[model samples]
Target: MPRSQPAIPICPPFPISGILRAARRRSDLSQRELARAAKVSAATVGRSESGTILPSINTFATLLAAAGFFLAVVDPDGNVLQPMKTRDDLRDGAERLYPAHLDVIPDPEPGEWWADIYGLARPPETFYRDRRRRDYQRRLSQWQVRVSKHRHLPEPRLHHYRDAP
Candidate 1:
């Protein structure tokens, strides 16, 4: 018998321009029509469909909505990714579980990118549950001392030394 190889999952390519054009065409809408319905300039729609410019998610969603289409985050096999809003999905066969307070969407700090999404909401960068808090503090303090001393003489000379003119 011949040996069979396991199938590897292939990632689906997201061709923005092609998708936009196809969706628009499917609705029989021209760039101008799509733009008008989306409340954007015709040039923007044309550029997006032609691949000359990349449209923001907001604008793209607007256009898709106008064309009776929708923008959805999907995985390789077209499975919708994270489709449920944390606030709305409370025990609707969800795979992830969290306490009520922690279940809702969290507000990210200013200049911070999607804090909760990146796990930044849990703790500071230096914190890890496996490491003892005291040990981490000691190491951090030592690091600070080394960093501060680094700007000073790399090596101190106890022997007599003179600066040359």
Candidate 2:
């Protein structure tokens, strides 16, 4: 028998279609114009406005940003979770609230670039030298361990000594 699964609580549906249409009209952009501005397909925008499908989060944000607006999270009681009036305000809020953490970057590509810079890629010479040093040190430690383990035993007579009369 199949195992019983826990019920997933249903989230209240957001009126994404209506919002998309209203925002686009307020921005004075046709569906095609908004699509072009947001770098998404025109058909996708049309479909989203028609409620046939919801656009991806990225698409939604792109479209809204094109209209000088953005999305914000709110608590279950409808209180804004991270309220801010502008991009700079958001930056200030994060800096004040989470000082030790990194600054929030709006662009996605730079985050990936930072990941590469962090550890995945390195300067060629430095990486090669560090890798070689680590390998040599590891091998030296292993050899020392092997030698210590057998240090108490007498050396076996060399089988290659043919003239040992």
Candidate 3:
């Protein structure tokens, strides 16, 4: 007899969008209708369904309320899921982090592109530094908004240059 491969997990860690979609379907609610009930835009529902964006904590709470489901999330196996908020999880779960460097470089001059390619004009180092700072601030703001609605959870601590040598 041949050995069988192990079964893979069918559900995702969060699967917030899937949960919302299921609830909406069970209620015969259109995305626009659900969004209206949740006091959010239809685009929000569409994005959530597509897994393109994770709703903020407040938004999630509102959605669950509208769907008549408790705010708690559960795994497919009926296990209650704990919050998985962490730097790495956020990095992976979010659409994208604010770009660390916002300096947009144009294509090099037509004929001179290959000449001293390494010496091409680059944005000032300070430009990158400023962009990094701004990105950090933007992330912090989002974190703050999330934590505000989840008052029971400890706030995330922001550390600058955490991995810099």
Q: Highest TM-score, which number? A: 1
Per-residue lDDT for 1-165 in model 2, tens only? Answer: 343567875787899999998999888999999988888889999999999987889889898997777998866678987643344334332344323223343333432333455655421111112333344455555555777875665543322224332
Cα error, candidate 2, residue 128 (Å): 41
User: What tens digits encode model 1's per-residue C-alpha lDDT throughout 1-165?
Assistant: 343567877767668889888889899998888889999999999998888999899988888899999877776778987754453333323544444322222332443333445554332211122223334445555556887755453433222223311
Q: Model 3, stretches more than 4 Å misplaced? A: 1-12, 73-165
- In model 2, the runs with Cα more than 4 Å from the true position are 1-11, 83-165
Better of 2 and 3 by TM-score: 2
- TM-score for each of the candidates: 0.45, 0.42, 0.38
Q: List the residue pairs that clash in candidate 2.
A: none
Error of 1 at 95 (Å): 25
lDDT string for model 3 (86-124, tens) is: 332222124443343343223324332233347755321
Residue pairs clashing, model 1: none
The lDDT, on a scale of 0 to 1, for candidate 1 is 0.63
